[model samples]
Target: MKERKIPEPKPLFIERMNRLIPDTNDQKNYWKIVKTEPVNTIRVNTMKINSEELIKKLEDYKWKLIQPWKNYPEILIVEGKTPSEREREILINKNLAKLEPGELGRTLEHLLGYYYIQELSSMLPIMALNPKENEIFLDLCASPGSKTTQAGNVMKNTGTIIANEVSLGRMRILASNLERCGITNTIITRKDGRSFCRKIKEQKIYFDKILVDAPCSGEGTLRSSPKTFLMWNPKTIKALSRLQKELLKSAFMTLKIGGEIVYSTCTHAPEENEGVINFILNEFKDKIEILDFELPLKTRPGLTQWEGKEYDSRVKKTKRVYPQDNNTEGFFLAKFRRLG
Candidate 1:
């Protein structure tokens, strides 16, 4: 397949970003326009039903199940028209008049807390984390509980999860989603993730696994919220990069020796993706090892070969999912294990 051409940076955007990251190349392209198809996905509550039984039930209803993710058995990919159209079609076809606005809201399974409406690609990083039963997990910047809920489902509601979000508004949304999904193993904390780490410092409350799904400039989410581009500027990216590095450092500190941390972002910017990871690796050299992970779907690793700047060799283990390749949001995920 030919490489999908990334969109060039707009002059206004370049001017703004250059002010923030002065040496930023005028030809640098971080945003890409690709056709995004909305996928209505659900994770079968393994606490409620097994994958086979869930598949059988959906098949009986004539709903075609796409391939199952390798690590997450209860999670299934379902095809439909994009976004609102797909939800409308499902309601009309199934005669689900009372269904709510979100994906899978009207489905009997969703009402019964059998599944959740998550973007298929969004589920990748959490799946890669592979939360195990009885393990203590921390979602440093978790909000709206997408990945947090996925971790809960993976543990089958057995372990404890610290779902921390800085904003009270997004925390409420996260709490509601967890409740709807019947997730009870999480403690919702409304605190800046970095401060939370410091507060718990002496408690020795290190996590078995920590997920640093840090905040980005929303460059990758432009397709979902195109209006974001209206405010897109390099200054925003630089500021977000600094914030990401700090959050990641705190996440690293909270990780138990020999534990793993999964760093991910929705943006395609190297400054936020590999650049942040490289900073952590350098600060904690000889104390962390990158893990290799591959998805069954087609994707690429970080563009380490970009420009003359060399990325850490460990970047090869990181995964990059493109909007054009996956028909989902552009994302980057890297798994790292602390060496004791």
Candidate 2:
């Protein structure tokens, strides 16, 4: 089979992003960063092994690993040339965890659940969630089990996590990853995340914490998944914004009073970031409040004004991580507390 060709980013997408980022020089830097390949990175699966042990094990294989951040010690930046197919399989067969060409998915360490090949930025929301032992948490859009498994590790496999994914195929993959990682506290469910409150009304289940990693235009993932530009448009962001708001509502409803919810997306579009958070703030002003949190990486505050429209001033507490900021994908994250 022929290798797939990555399509050039669409002009409209570029124009809209350029407009969103007012700094011309930074915009130029972002363009240069996204068009090139992203760095290869992974997180140590603490459930299987601690970062110290993993680093020593990989070092034996002649791999150099750099800790991404002092705050995020489990994440490591891998430095190496892309391995040939034969070399990759050899490394995998040896149970070594290393970067593969095209960021391929198959590897023995992955099968053995030693580590997870996650993007550096994609791991932030779970970190923000800060799952603890014996707490009940909900992952509204958990799929392929990256965050869910990470949550299990954070909980020390002691808490119950409802991992919900609407798609059957993705649910299967999520289950597989959970099993591979020895995550036993999570209960898998297939359902529309927006309908959870209504579907489980009789049960009256409430979570101590919730994560709504809503689906969006994925504008920030252009470096890893270049085809995002092909499917991206202002209209798509508009449509997903409605769905995202509904999902946020369901998460808030299912969260116990005083529980915290982390809402995140892989898009820079303000409509899906500050805009959705603003809508929730207005709709649930008396019941919810945005909480300020800090990350080790540099981040821009959530946009207060976009396209001449102003957002809730409190939305400024939300954080935006740009590609240029940390050489990672663009991501938005906000933490909310149920005040009622």
Candidate 3:
């Protein structure tokens, strides 16, 4: 009998990660965690449900939920185990299957938008942004509206949120999520994110805060979407990085002098993360300031050097959340403020 072989990312991907993370043991752990499944975490929609009431309703189903933060009861880490074969033998004979871990999304609570099944790391961009009531916000490159809905929750549907996406199909999904989550303050827009920002800048309009959750090579999504291993390409990363830089430039232009912008991505590619931030910092010079912030999860600071390229020193304030460090998808987050 032949032994089963495990799958891994492309050599180029491995090589790049090795370069980014030089520690031999750390690299091994990184790859090991990347191949594992992420934990189930959901964000409670305060607009529609109280965290305690929702927890009471969910616990009746025998699901174990842990609220990682006392202050953030909205974030729930779900954990539950199915009965063993012997324990479930009677139910099996009775033709009934017990609910399992993946069934959270189909629950009544989910359909009612009482909560959103989002990755813990994916929710951090909004947490860091700390959206306030009655403030103008923009989610550039928003699709499927996860962060948009989260922002809507934080703002209690008071402020206006411009959720922009270029693709019509994705825009539809974004609209659906926003509607399902009872997010009334968001306006869906169909346009290239950079061009839309530039146009809005021409109108002399500015946002209080913006989120550029840029699309990238998606190497960080390996656990959820293994196909990213094959889809990873150096050329694609370069192209995406260029587009990200332009989007940041346009977003920066449309930001008020005291406005903040959170740039994030679900990719470990330095060129798309720190490299993009570096490009914007240099182009804008003193006009942009990288902000230092904190999160509930463990995070590493942004890389200052990769592939012989050096980024601005201020980029050290950027946060990098790896799959190994946290039981979630890999994510890069950088918060910025417009100074000039």
Candidate 4:
């Protein structure tokens, strides 16, 4: 048996990050550049089929399934041939003479609503929230419905979910995704999540759980989509952080006492991840408590002491998943519960 050498973090890049974030040393050995492969992950619609039945159905197609985590029974890491490979397989397996260009598009399961293609890392935040059946949940700034759809599936369509998005174009995509995923318990709203929160407060309404998957500089998603890194700049990170703080404040206000809120971002920047969570905890110190949600997989906690800046001790409860460690997009998630 041979020993495998662990990859080390890039020195120059890490040094720069240390300058930007004092606690860089906490993640020194944990960071590394890893190849990002586009994976097609599907969340089973438990509302429509249980995990056992879904696995049985997918097994018919000989799709290899990997059970990555426990809490999510419907979650599976599937291995299948590429689009062209699947096309050929379908023709041979189903005895079809030739595959039409739209055959995959017109499949009954897809049309009738069976599953959704989502990034494994993108799905982590919603899974962390762990929405229960019949609970009221809101996806602040939800668009394209990846997290929204996942939350809906988690609730098994028994809860009320308000999926809010500011962009009309993105809202349409969200609606379409919900339709395809057969998610009917959600109300799609086109309004700034901050404003929506104010209205909910005026009406004296509160949500059981809220997800503030805030907009960020998208630095963590560079490997998943290069466009993110192409547009990244120091100024953009600062600007997005300001908006994220406001959104977090609103989300905090709209949550009922004893309810929980999960804050997450795809960016690796601390300004958006730990910084935002730190701000919220300080502002609402007496009203909320940080909940340490355990990850099914191993991960690093937020830096306790970074670069001469003392972050709130609560920041230690946050989780960070590096691309090199998870073989997925970089992500950060922190769950907080409202106190009476």
| Best candidate (score: lDDT) | 3
TM-score, every prediction? 0.80, 0.91, 0.93, 0.82
Which rank order by TM-score, best down to worst? 3, 2, 4, 1
Looking at model 2, report the run of 10 residues with the lowest lDDT sum.
Answer: 95-104
Best by TM-score: 3
Tell me model 3's lDDT, rounded to 2 decimals.
Answer: 0.87
Local lDDT at 84 for model 4? 48
Pairs in steric clash, model 4? 22-307, 23-306
Q: Over the stretch 241-324, how does candidate 1's per-residue lDDT look in tens digits?
A: 899999988888889898889999987777888888888888888888889876656667765543366778788778887665
Local distance difference test scores for all models = 0.75, 0.85, 0.87, 0.76
Tens digit per residue, CA lDDT, model 4, 1-340: 1122333334544564555444555454323343334344567766676778777766555555666777777777665422445566665443223323333234455466676656678888887888999999999989989899888887878979999999999999999989888888999989988898999899998999999999887766755465553465677878998999999999999999999999999877788888888899889988989999876665679865554667998798999887656666778899999996
Residue 252 shift from truth in candidate 3, angstroms: 0.6
Per-residue alpha-carbon lDDT of model 3 for 279-329, expressed as tens digits? 998899999888998899899999999888888888899999888877789
**Root-mean-square deviation of candidate 1:** 6.4
* Preferred candidate (TM-score higher): 1 or 2: 2
Q: Using alpha carbons, what is the TM-score of model 2?
A: 0.91
Q: After superposition, how far is residue 207 of candidate 1 from its true place, in Å?
A: 0.8
The residue pairs in collision within model 2 are none
The stretch of ten residues in a row with the least summed lDDT in candidate 4 is 1-10
Q: Find the 10 residues in a row with the least total lDDT in model 1.
A: 26-35
